[model samples]
Target: MKSIAVKNIKGRPARSVILVVISMLLTFAIFGGTMVISSLDSGLSALENRLGADIMVVPFEATTQKKFDDIVLQNAPGYFYMDNARVQQVLEREGIAQASEQFFLASASASCCSVAVQIIGYDPETDFTITPWIKKSYSDSLGELDVVVGNDLNAFVGDTISFYGVDCKVAAKLDKTGTGFDTAVFTTKDTIKRLIQSSVDLGMNIFGKVDPENTVSCIMINAAAGFTPEEVVNDINLHVKNVKAIQSKELISGVSDSLGGVSGIIRVLICAVWILGVVILLLAFTMSVNERRKEFAVLRVAGAARSRLAGIVLGEALMICIIGSILGVLLGFAVILPFNGVIEQALGLPFLLPGAGRCAGYALASLLLCTLSGTLAAAVSALRISRIDTGVILRGDN
Candidate 1:
C-alpha cells in the first residue's frame, strides 16, 4: 500500500511538489514566527532585569542632546557631564533608598575603521546594577585599570584594550544581558575618571570645561519601602538641580510597546500564511483525487479495500508534509540563527535567541502542526474517492 502511494506521488511530480510547497510554507511560518516572538520577549525581560534600578537621573542637556534610550538602552556612544554633587543631592531626596552614580564617555575614534563605543564607570562599592553581572563572571573586586567587557564586545579576559591612550586589562567578560549593556564596556569609577583625564590630555576632550573631579553622567536609584518608583522619580526631579529624573518603566515603555506590536504583526502573518497553505493543499488534493478517479477505480477492482485506498491517500500527504516540514525547519535555522544580530539591529530591539532545547521544541511543534494540517486537507478527498462507484469511474460514466 505504501509502495502504491509512493508511486502515485512520484507519477504526479508537479502536483506533488505544489502540495509539498504548501506544507513547507505552513511549517516555515510557524517556526520563524515562534522564534522571533520568543527572542523579542526574552530580550525585553533581560533588559528589565539588567537595569535593576527603578529610576535614572541624567543631566537635562543629555536628554535634549540624545534620548535616554539611545544613550543607554541603545548604547549610542555619547558623553555628558552633570555635577557629581547631584548624586548626594538626589540621595537626600525623600523616598530615595539606594543610589549609585555612573560616569559615561564615548571611546575615542580609533585610527582604524572602529566606531566609537560607550565607556561606563560605576562605583563598585555603591553599585547594585552591574555588580550582579560582574559577579557571575568574576567574584573578585576589579583591580585598578581592570575593566569588564560586555558579552558582545570583541575583547576578552586578559586582553588589553585602549581608550584615549589609556590601556586597561579586561578582567572579565559579562554574560549576555540582551540589552545595550551587551556592547558597552564597564569599569570602576576611578578607572573611568582616569580615562577621562587621559582624553583631556590627548585633546580628545568630549566634555569641555566639565571638571572630571566633580562630574557624573547619570544616577541610578531604587525607591525605599512604601514609596512607588513614580513618587521617587517625582521627588528627585523636584529636588535635584540641573537633572532629569525618569522612572525606569517610562524609559522602556517604548521598547516594550514596539516589541508587542512586532510580535502581533508576526502572529497575524503566520496565521494568514498557515490558513492559505491549508486551503491550497486542500484544493490540490481534491483536484488530484478527481484526476486519478479512474486509477483508484482500477485499484478497487483489483481487490483493494476502501480503507486501503484511504490509507494510500493519507500516506502520500504524510510523506510530503514530513519532507516539507523538515526542509522548512532547516531553512528557518539557517536564516534566523545566523542573522539574529542583523535582525536585532533592524528591529532596534534587544533580541536573544531562546536556548537550544526551546528552539528544538518549536521546530518539533511546527512540524507536527503543519503535518496535521496537510493530512487533514487530504482526508476529505480521500473519503470521497473511496466512496465513488468503481464501475462508474472506470466506465467514464461519472
Candidate 2:
C-alpha cells in the first residue's frame, strides 16, 4: 500500500514538488519566526539582569542622551567624562543606597590597547554591580594591573592587553551579557588612572589633560529599601548638577517597545506565509485528487476498501511533510547559526538564541504542525473520493 502511495506521488512529479515546497515554506515560517522571537526575549531578559543597577548617571552634555543610548542600546563603544563629585552627589540623595563611580577611556587608533574598545573603570570597594557578577567566575578582587575582558573580546585569561603601552593582565573573562558590557574591558579605578598616565606619557592624550583622579565617566546606583528606581532617578536629577540620571526601567521600556514592533512585523509575515502555503497546498492537493479519481475507482473495483484509499492519499501527504519539514528546519538553523553575529549587529540589540533543548523542542513542534496541515489538506480529497460510488465513477457518470 505504501509502495502504491509512493508510486502515485512519483507519477505526478510536478504536484508532488509543489506540495513539498509549500510544506517547506510553512515549516520555515514556524521555525524561523519562533527562533528569532525566542532569542530576542532571552537576550532582553539577560540585558536587564546584567545591568543590575537601578539608574545610570552621565554628564549632561549636548549629545549625552544620544551617546548614552548608543552605548547601552546599540553597544557602541564611547568615552565621556564628568567630575567624580557627581557620584558623591548622587549618593547623598534621599533613598539612594549606594553609588559607584565609573571612569571611561577610549583607546586611540594608534594606542597599544584594542582599537575602539570602551575601557570601563569601576571602584571595587564601592561597586555593587559588575563585581558581584564577576564573582560568579572569580572570587578575588580585581588587581590594579588585572582586568576582566568581556566575553566578546578576543583575549583570554592570563593574556596581557596593552593600554597605551601599559600591559594589563586579563584576570578573567566575563560571561556573555548580550549588551555593551560583553564588548567592554573592565578594570579597577586605580588601574585606569595608571593607563591614563601611561597614555599621557606616550603622548596619546586622547582626552587631553583630563585628570583621571578627579574625573569619572558615569555613576551606577542602587536604590535603598522603600525607594523605587524612578523615584531615585527623579531625586538625583533634581539634586545633582551638571549630570543626568536615567532610570534603568526607562531604557528597558524603550528597548521593549522597539522589540515589540519588530516582533509584530515578523508575526505578520509568518502568518501571511503560512496562509499562502496552506492555500497553495490545498489547491495542489485538490487538483491531484481530481486527476486520480479514475485510479481510485479502479482500486475500489479491485476490492480495495475506502479506508485503504484514504490511507494511500494520507501516506503520500505524510511523506511529503516529513521530508519537507526536515529540510526546512535544517535550512532555518543554517541561516540562524552562522549569521547570528551579523544579525545582532544589524539589529543593534541584544540577541541570544535558544539552548539546545529548546531548539529541539521547536523543531519537533514545527514538524508536527507541518504534518498536521498536510494531512488536513489531503484528508478533504481523501474523504470525497472515498465516499463516491465506485460503479458511477467507473461508468463515467458525472
Candidate 3:
C-alpha cells in the first residue's frame, strides 16, 4: 500500500515537494531564532545562580554631582567610592557568611581601538566566584599588570594595552561570559588604583594613588545558609552606612526584563516568517490536491476505502514534510555559523550552539508537528474526493 502511494506521488511530486520545503523552512526559522535567544537567557541565569551571592553593595556617595540612589539603582555609569574597611565590617554582621569587593573602571578610547573595560579589582585569594573559572581556564600565571581579558574584548592574549598610561599584558583570554563582565577587564585593587593616578591621553582621571586610603565601587555579600535574601538586604540597609544592598534575583531579573524591546522585535519577526511560510505551503498543497482529484476518485472506485485513501494522501504530505524539515534545519545552522563570533562580541555574551544531538531532536520534533498538520489537512481534503459520484466524475472527465 505504501509502495503504491510512493509511486503515485512520484507521478507528479513537484508541488508536494515544494509545499514540504516551504513548511520546513518556516518552522526552522521560527524555532531557530527562539532557541538562540533562549540559550542566551539560560547562560545568564546560570551565571546568576552560580554566583550564590545574596546582595550587591555599591558606594552610594561616589557620585556627588548626581543622586547616588539613581546611579546605583538605575545603572547610570559613575564612580562611587566606599571605604575598603567596610569589607570586614559587612562580614562581621550576623547572617553574613562572606563578602567580596569589585572596583569598576569605566571604558576609555585608545589610540587604535575604542573599548570599555570593567576592571574588577578582586582579592584573588578570597574571590571564590572567579577563582574556579580562572583556575580551569588558566594556571597561577594571572597576576598584577597581567590581565584576563573577556572573550569579547576584541584583543588577543599577547596584545599590549595602555590604559591611564599604565601598560599591561593580556595574560589570558576568557571564554564568552555573556554578560557585562564579558566586556570587562579583571585585575587586582592596587593595580587599578595606580592606573587612576596616572593621566592618559583622554585626560580622564580614573585612578587615584595619591592617598594611602582607598574605596571600592561595590561589595558582593553571600548570605549564611538558611538566611533569606530579603532579610539580608533589610538587615544591611538598616545597619550599613553610605551604601545600598540589592538582592541578586531582583537585579538580574531587572536587567533581563529591560531587554523586552529587543526580545519583542525578534519574536515579532519570527511570527511573520512562520505566517508567510504557512501561506506558501497552504497554497502549494491546495493546488496539488486539486490536480489529483481524478486520481483520488479512481482509487475510491478501485476497492480502496475512503479511510485508506485518506492515509495515502497524508503519507505523501508527511514524506515531503520530513524531507523539507531536515533540509531547512541544515540551512538555518549554515546561516548562523558565519556570524557566531561577531554575535558573541557585539552582545558581550557567550553562545550555546546546539550540538548534533540537540539539532537532530529539534528537527525531528519540527517535522513531526508539521507532518501531523499536513496529514490532517490532506485527510480533510481526501474526504471531499469520497463525496463525489465516481461515475459522474470519471465519465465527465477526459
Full-model lDDT for every candidate: 0.86, 0.81, 0.64
Query: Would you give me the overall lDDT of model 2?
Result: 0.81
Q: Which residue runs of candidate 3 sit more than 4 Å off their true CA positions? A: 1-14, 50-52, 61-79, 85-89, 112-115, 199-203, 206-213, 258-287, 299-308, 337-360, 383-389, 396-398
Off-target runs (Cα >4 Å) in candidate 1 are 112-115
Give the runs in model 2 whose Cα sits over 4 Å from its true position. 10-14, 62-65, 203-206
Instruction: Provide the lowest-lDDT 10-residue window in model 2.
Output: 62-71
Candidate of highest TM-score: 1
Ranking by lDDT: 1, 2, 3
**Top-lDDT candidate index:** 1
- The residue-by-residue lDDT of candidate 3 on 1-398, one tens digit each, is 45666886677666656676676777677557765665566555645743446788765555354544333332223455667666556656777777777665655665522454556656675675666676656677466777777766787878878776678888888765455445567776667666555433345744443231466777778888888778888887788776677787776565466445446766898778766666666566666767777877788788888777667766776777667766767676776656755664555443445556766676666666655655555565566655667677678787
lDDT of 3 at 122: 66
